[model samples]
Target chain A: MKAVQLKDIRKSYGQNPEVLKGINAAIEPGEFFVLVGPSGCGKSTMLRIIAGLEEVSEGELIIGSETANRLRPNERDLSMVFQNYALFPHLTVEQNIMFGLHVKKIAKSEQIKRCKEAAEMLGISDYLMRKPKELSGGQRQRVALARAIVTHAPICLMDEPLSNLDAKLRARMRSEIRQIQRKLGITMIYVTHDQTEAMTMADRMMILNHGEVQQVGKPLDIYNNPQNTFVASFIGSPPMNLTAAHVNKGKLQIANKWNIKVDGYQDGEVIIGVRPEAILPANEGLPAADVKVANVEVLGTETLVSFELEGNKQWIAKWPGQWSAEIGEILQVSVDHNKIELFDAVTGERLEKTHSKKVLEVVL
Target chain B: MSLPQAQQETQSFVKQRWLGNSRRFASLLEGLLYLLPSILLFTVFLFYPLMKTLYLSFFYSDAQGVPLSFAGFDHFVQLFSSSSFMTSMKATLLFVLYTVPPGIILALALALLANEKLRGIGFFRTIFSSTMGMSVAASSVIWMFMYNPAIGIANRFLTWAGLSEIQWLLDPGWALISVSIATIWMNTGFTFMILLGGLQNIDSQLYESAKIAGVSRFYSLRKITLPMLSPTLFFVITVSMINAFQTFGQIDILTKGGPMETTNVIVYAIYKDAFINYNVGSASAQAVLLFFGILIVTLIQFKLGERKVHYQ
Candidate 1:
C-alpha cells in the first residue's frame, strides 16, 4: 500500500522563483525513501512541505490515501524528526515522546505504555526522565525518532536526522534508524545530502538538484545508471568523470586525436561518463592514453589518483593501495567499454542505455 | 648575539608591549573622562540632596532657625501623630491599590494587541508607546482640563449623552480615582513597550513546536509564553509600583488635595509641608517613609520574581 504520494508538488517563496518544481513520488508502506541533494537544492523545503510545515504552492499530497494538502501537521498524522532534533527543551525525553499523544488526549496509562515501548525499542528506556539538554546528540536523535515512532503514524518525515552527529555516531544511528523503521514498518521519508546514507539506507531514492528531481530510482540503479550528467556526477564520492567525446560506430574520440572504442553509440558529439572505479590501468580492450599523474590520495585500502586527460578534463581513478603510481609520471589509462555511459553533449541526456547487470523496474 | 644582550632585547620588547597595551588603555580613561562630568552632576543634584534629606529627617529647626537640635524619633512621632500625614499615607496606599493591577492589565492588553501578527502593527505599537514621550506634568494638566465640570470634554460629552455629570476631580470621593485613571493612562505605554519587547523576544519556534504537538494556542501561551515572560512582567510590575509611589504630579495638578484632602498623596503632602509650609524636617521624615515603603515593596517583588523567572 502506498503510504504517501506527492504529485506535481510545487513551492515558491513570495514572488521568487520556485524552489521545488513539480516533484512527484510515491513512498510505499514501510519503504525508506531518501531524498539526496546538495545544499540549497530545496530538499529540506520539500521535506517541510511533506511534514506540512510549509504550504504547498501547488500540488496534491496524499498520505495513507487521504488527500492532505489542507491538513495541518498534527492533523495529517505524520510525525517529523527535525534535523536539529527539535526536542522540546522544556520537556523530558518521556514527555517529548508523549507530547503528541497527550495533545490528542490519550489516556494516561496508554500514553505511558506507548512511551515506554518506544523508549525500549530505541534503547533509550534508561534516559526517559532526562531532559533533551541532558542527552548526547545521538540520544537526542533517538528521542526524536522515538517521538515520531510513538505517534504510530504511518508516515515519518526525517530531515537530515543524522547530520548533527559525529562520523561514527552518524553511521551507528543510520543503521539504528533503518533497524527501527524495519521493526516498526513505518514509511519513512528521509532527507539528506549524504550519498552514502542514501546508498546504504534508502529502499529507493530521489536525487534533486536546483529544485528539480534529477532522478528517482533504486539506490544501485542510480549509482549504476544515472539518467544525466548531473545525477552521474553528483551521486558518487569522487563523482563520475564527464568528458566531451564523440561516440560514433562504437568508437570514442577525444581531443580530436585519441580514439577508443566502446560498444553501442550511433553518432554525434557525446559526453562520456564513467565512475572513478570504472577506469582502471590502460589495458587490452581499448586504446590507452598517456596521462601525467598530478596527485594521489592514499586511503587505507585504496588510493585515489587524479590525472588530467586530454583537453584538460580531470579524471580521478580509484586504484588499490598496492597499485604502483608516482606523481608526474605519464601513465596509460583505459576504460571498461561496457561500463561507459554516453550522453549528448548539448542536451545532457543519455544517448544509449549502457548495458548493466540489472534492469530498473519502474513502478508505473 | 650574546645571552645578556638577547635577554636585554627580549626585556625591552616585553616592556614595549606592556606599555603599548597600557597606552591603548587610554581609551578607557577617555571614556571615564566623558562620564565624570555627568557622574559629578548626579552626585551633587541627586545623591547629595537625598543624603541631606535623610540627614535632615533626624533634626528639628523651628521658625527662629537658631536653636537647631537633633530630634531623631520626634519627627517620625510627629509624622505618625499628624492626621494629614496619616491621610496622605492612606491615600498613597489607596492610589497603589487603584493603579497597579489596572496598569498591568491595560499594558498587557495593549502589548498583546501590538504583538499580534496583524497589519500596521508597528504603527500601532508606536502610537501606544508614544504616550511614554509625554511628561507626567503635561498629562496631569491635560487630564485636569478634561475632567473639569462645566466645560471639560468628559463632562460635556457625558451631559451631551444625557448622563449626569458626576464630579471627577471636585468630589472628594472621586478625586483619587480620577488621578489614578490619569496615571494609568500616562504610564501604561512604558509597560506596554516592555511587555511587547518580552513578547518579541520569545522564540517563535516554541509556538511552532506547540502547534506541531497539537497543543492549542491558548495552552501554548499559558505554558510557554507566560513562563518565559515572567521576568519581564516582574520588571514591569516592580518599576510600575515604584512609579505609582511617586505619582503625586497628577493629584497635585488635578485636585490640589481639595475637598477634604482625599487626593493628597505622600509626595504632595511632603511638598506642601517642605515648600509651602516650611516644615522641611517633617517633610524629610515623610520622604524617608516613602523610600522605605518603595524599598520593601520592590524587595518583596524581587523575592517573588526569583521563583517565577524562567530563563528561557
Candidate 2:
C-alpha cells in the first residue's frame, strides 16, 4: 500500500549549499500527507523531486513500485498543482482538463466523460468554455485541480495551491481539498508554509525545518506532545513558550515557579515548553509562578492573554471569550505537571520520558 | 471697519484668480515651447512640399518647361496605359507576395530559437537584431556580390555542392525572387526581436500547465504560443510590408531595373519617373497609390489580428 516512497533523497544545487538533505518517507495509499515548512526549507523542492520535475541528487523516488529517479515529469504518471495554479491561459476549461488525456491520445468519448465528471465534482460544469483569465481566483484553482484529477493519476502533488487565496477562501478551500482527496482516495502530498493549513488538512503532516524533518504525526499529537522545543514552537498559533529552567532532584524550577515535579531529569538546566492553553490561573495543588500579563488578543469565543515570567520569557494563556485582563496586571500562572516538556537547551533534545510507541519526538 | 475687511478679502480673491490664470498661461506657453521646433520644421519641409505636390499632380508640364494645361487625372490615366508602370505594379505585388511569408517564417524561427533557456542568449539575440543596423543599400550591395554570376560565394557553394550553376540575380525569372530573398534575410531579425520580446512577455506558467496536461510542445507552440504571439506577428508583418513597398534601395543598388525590368518594383519605378524622367506629378500619383496599398494591407492585418490576440 505504499503509494510513494522517497528513500534517503538528498538534493543540493551545485555546491552552494544542501537544500534537501537525506529525506526518507513512505506515503500510504489514499493518505493525505502534508509537508509543512518555512521558506527555504526545500519542501517544494522535495515535492518537485517526487514529480520528477527535478532530478534526485541521490537516493531513490519510488512511485507505485517504480523507481522514477531518472524519469521525466511527463512520464512519472503524477499530476502537480502549483502555488500559482498554472492553468493554461489559452485553453478553455474543458480543454485544460482534457489536455493530458488528449496528449495520451485517450478516446474522445472517455476524455469528455472524465472532464465532465471532474468539472461536476468541482462545481465548475457550466464554465467549460471559459478561458482561465475569465474565471475568478478560486475558479481558476478548481480548474487546476480538475486538470490534475482528470488525469486519474494515483498521486497528486500540491505545492501551496491555496496560498494565493484570501484568508477566508483559504480556510474554505482547505476543507474542500481534504474532501476531494478523501472522495477520490488518491495519495496526495501537499506542501505549505502555513502551519494552520498543515494542522487542519493533513491526515498526517510532516513538519520540516532547515531541510530536515522535524516531526510527522497526526495534528493533535504534534500539538500536545512535541518531541522537542522546535516543534512545540512551530506547530501552534503564536508558538509555545520555552523558559530556561532546571530540573533539580526531580523538581522543575522555572525562575520563581517552584515545587514542580518532573519525572526523570535530575540536576541539569533544561528548556521548559508549555503551550498557551496549557497554562492556567493557578489553583490548588499546583506551583505558583509570577506572571505579568503583557497583551491580550480577543477572539469571539476565546481571549488569548500573553504573559511574561522571570527572565522576560513570554507564554500565552487562553481563557473564555468573555474574559478580560488589564495590561499591566500581575497574574499567577500554572500548568499540569505532565503537560510540561523539559529539554536540553543547548542540544535542543527532549529530556523527558521516551516510549517505543506513541513517542512524540518532534525535532527541527 | 467691516467694509475695509470685506475689501481686503476681495483684493486677496482677485490676486488668487490672477495667479490661476497666469499659471494656465505659463503651462500653455511651456507646451508651445516644446512643440515649436518640430512644428516649424514640419511646416518648412513636409507640409509645404505636400501642398506643392498636391498642386502639381493636377498639371501637365510639357518638355518645353511650361505648364501647358491643367490636366485632371490625365497622368493617372496615362500611367495605367504605360506598360512599364503596369509591369512595375505587378512586380511590386509579386514582391509583397514573395517577401511577407518568408520574412514572417524566418522571424518566427529565429525568435523560437532565441527564446530557448540557454547561456549567451543575449549575445545571440543581439547578433540577430544587429542586422537592423545595416542599411538596405548596404545589405543589397553585399548580396549583389553574393549573387555574382561567376565567382559569387552562393553560386560557388552550389557548384561545389555539385549543383548546376543557377543564375541568381541575372535571370529574369529569378530576379525579383532573388531581391526578396535578400530583403527577407536582412529584415527578419527586426521582426525576430519584436516577436522574441512578445514571447518573453507570455507567462511561462501557461506553458508549464500545458505540458502537465500532456500537451506536446508542438501543440502548445501552435495553440498557445502562436495565438499569444499574434500581436507581435501582426506588428512585424505591418512594418515589413511597409518596408517591402518602399523597397527601392535594394533594386537601385543591385538590379538597376535590369533582367528585362523584372526587378522594377513600385518605389524604384517612382524614382525613375520622378528623378530620371523628371515627371514629379506621375511619381506623386504612384506614391499616393503605394500609400493606399500599404494602408489597406495594414488595416487588413490589424482586422485579422484583433480576433487572434489573447489580451491576457
Candidate 3:
C-alpha cells in the first residue's frame, strides 16, 4: 500500500477558468478515501490526476515518497476502474482480467492462477469465456473489479464505478467492493456524486463544491460538525435546514416571529442550520414555534414534514412515526438549542459555540 | 332457434378465418410491390444474361452469338485442355495473390497512421482518400504514362539511381506486377476510408485502460486494435479478393492482355474471346467457370475467416 499526497493541485484547460483550484490532501496508506460532490465539482478530475491520465497544471504529487507528477499513466503502478466499466469488448472475461498480467509479461501459470483467483473472489468464475456484452451490467462491474484486483497495484482509483448499475445491484456491489478493498488492503481513492455511498463506505471523506474542499474528516465527524453552510446542507439526507436570522445581545430573532435567549455571542445577522431529524413535535421542555405545514410525505415508518420559514425558505423535519399532517394546517415544532448550528450570514462560516448553558426561552 | 344460432356462429368463424388469410396475402403482395423495381432490373440485366450465358456455354455459337449446334460440353472440354486458357487461369490467380494482400495491408497501414490524434491530419486523410474520387479509366490512363519507358517517372527514378531502366508494361514478366501495383493504389482509397472509419468507431476508453495496464503501443495494436477491427478487415479482404478476380478496366487500359499474355486475367480473356475473336461459346464457358470460382472462394473465406471475427 502507498500513501498519496497532493499539495496545492490545480488544473485548467487552455485559458479557461480552473477546474480544480488548489487542492491539498494526504491520503494514508490502505485508507478508503472517498471524494464526494455534486456534478462538475472536480472530484473525478482529482482522481484522474492521481491516476496520471491527466496532468496537474500546478501541484506536487507524491506517491509512496516519490514525486509522480512527471510519470506516465502506465508508470504510475496503479490500477483504475472507470465509470463505464471500460472492458475490452473483443476480449473474453478471462482475457480482460489478465490484460494487465499479460502486459507485465508475468509467467503463464502465474497469470492463470491470479486470474482464476480474482474471478472466483468476484464470484464470476463461470463467466470466464463470456464476452463483456454477454454479461449483465452488474456482472460487467465485477469483471472490471477483478481486472483491477489481479494487478495487485498498491493503489486503486475508481471513478464512480457503481453508477452504471441498478439501485439494488449498486447496493450489493457497494459492500462487495468495500470488502474487496479491505481484504486486499489497497489504498482506494473513490469518486462519487452519491452522498449515501460516501457516508457509508468512506473511512475518511472529503466534501467538495465548485473546485474547493469544504471539509474532510470521518463521515460522522463531518456530518455532525460541518464546517460551513455548504457542508451542512450537502452531507445529510433532505439536508440541514438553513434560514436567515438575527442575533442581538444574547437574543436570537427568527423570521421576526420567535425570539430565543442565546447568551455569550455578539449581536449580528446569522444563518441557523438544523438537521431534519432534530426538529420534533412541540413539547413543554423545548423552545417551540407555531408554523403552518407546506408539505407532508408519509414514508410508512417515518414521515417528512416541511414548513416555510421567513422569505419562503422551506425547512423539513423528519419525524419518527407516520404523520398525517395536512398541508396548510397549523402545527407546532420545537428545536433543541444545542442542536442548532449558526453560521455567519455573509461568509457562511460556522460560528464558535457559546460557553453559557442556559436553557433558551422562546417568546412567540 | 338452436340450429340457426349454431349456423350463424359457424358463418362468423369462417368469415374471420377468411379475413386473416386475406390480410396475410395482402401483406405478401405489398412486400412484392416494394421489391418490384430491383427485381425487374436484376432479371433484365443480371438473371437473363446469366441464363443465356449458361445456355451458350453448351453449344457452338455463330459470330452474332446465335447458337449454331449442340456441342455437348465441347467448349468446357476444349477449355480444360487449351494451354492459353490455362495461362489465363494462372495469370488470374497470380494477379489475385499479388493485389489482395498487398492492397489490404497497405490500406490498413495507412489507416493506422491516419488514426493518430495529430494536428493537420485532415490534410493527409484527404490526400490519402483522393484516389477514390478518380474513375478507373482516368487513373489507368495516368498509370499508363507513368509506366512509359522514356517519359515515365518510374524509369526516371531508376535511371537517376544509376540502375538500368527496365520496361514496366512492355516486359512479359513485369506486366502482371505493374497492373497489380496500379490496382492496389486505385483500390486503397476506399479500403483506407472504411478501415479508418472502423478504427474511429472503437471506444477510446479501451485504449486508455490498456495504457493504464502498461501495454506497449505495438502490443495493444496486435491484441486490442486488430481483434476489434477483425470484422472490418474480414469485409475488406473478401471485397478486395472478389475485385481482384474480376479486374478488367485497368487491364483493358494498360496491358490489353499483351506482352505474351502475362496479364491475361479471366475477365479480360473472356472479353477478348467474345468481342475480338467472336468465340462466344468459349467466352460463355469461361464466364460460367469464373462465377463458380468466385462463389467457392467466397464461401471458403466465410467458413475460415468468420470464426476469428469479433463482431461487437
Q: Give per-residue CA lDDT, model 1, range A106-177, as digits (tens).
A: 899999999999999889999999978889989998998888887788788888989999999999999989
Q: lDDT tens digits, residues A1-364, model 2?
A: 2389889999998777788888888889999999998998989899888876678888988888889888777777778898888776767899878875867778999999999999999999999999999999999999999988998887899999998999999988999999999898989999999999999998898888888888888999988888778888889987887888876775667666455655546577889887777777776455556678899888978889988776566678776655677888888766755567777878887775744332322111
Model 3 docking tier (incorrect/acceptable/medium/high): medium
Q: Higher TM-score: candidate 2 or 3?
A: 3
lDDT of 1 by residue, B230-253 (tens): 888988888888888887777777
Tens-place lDDT digits, model 3, residues B182-281: 9999999999999999999888878889889988899889988999999999999999999999999999999999889999999999999999999999
Q: Which numbered prediction scores highest in DockQ against the true structure?
A: 3
Error (Å) of candidate 3 at residue B218 is 2.6
Model 1 regions more than 4 Å off:
A245-258, A262-270, A281-287, A293-295, A309-313, A322-332, A354-364, B1-50, B61-68, B113-120, B133-146, B150-163, B248-261, B267-273
For model 3, name the residue pairs that clash. none
lDDT of each residue in B148-238, candidate 2, tens digit only: 9877898999889999887998899999988889988888778888989999988776776665566778888998899888777777788
Give one clash count per candidate, in the order shown.
0, 2, 0
lDDT of 1 at B84: 85
Better TM-score candidate (1, 2): 2
lDDT of 1: 0.84
DockQ of 2: 0.46
True-vs-predicted CA distance for residue A121, candidate 2, Å: 1.5
lDDT (C-alpha) at residue B257 in model 2:
81
- iRMSD (Å) of candidate 3? 1.2
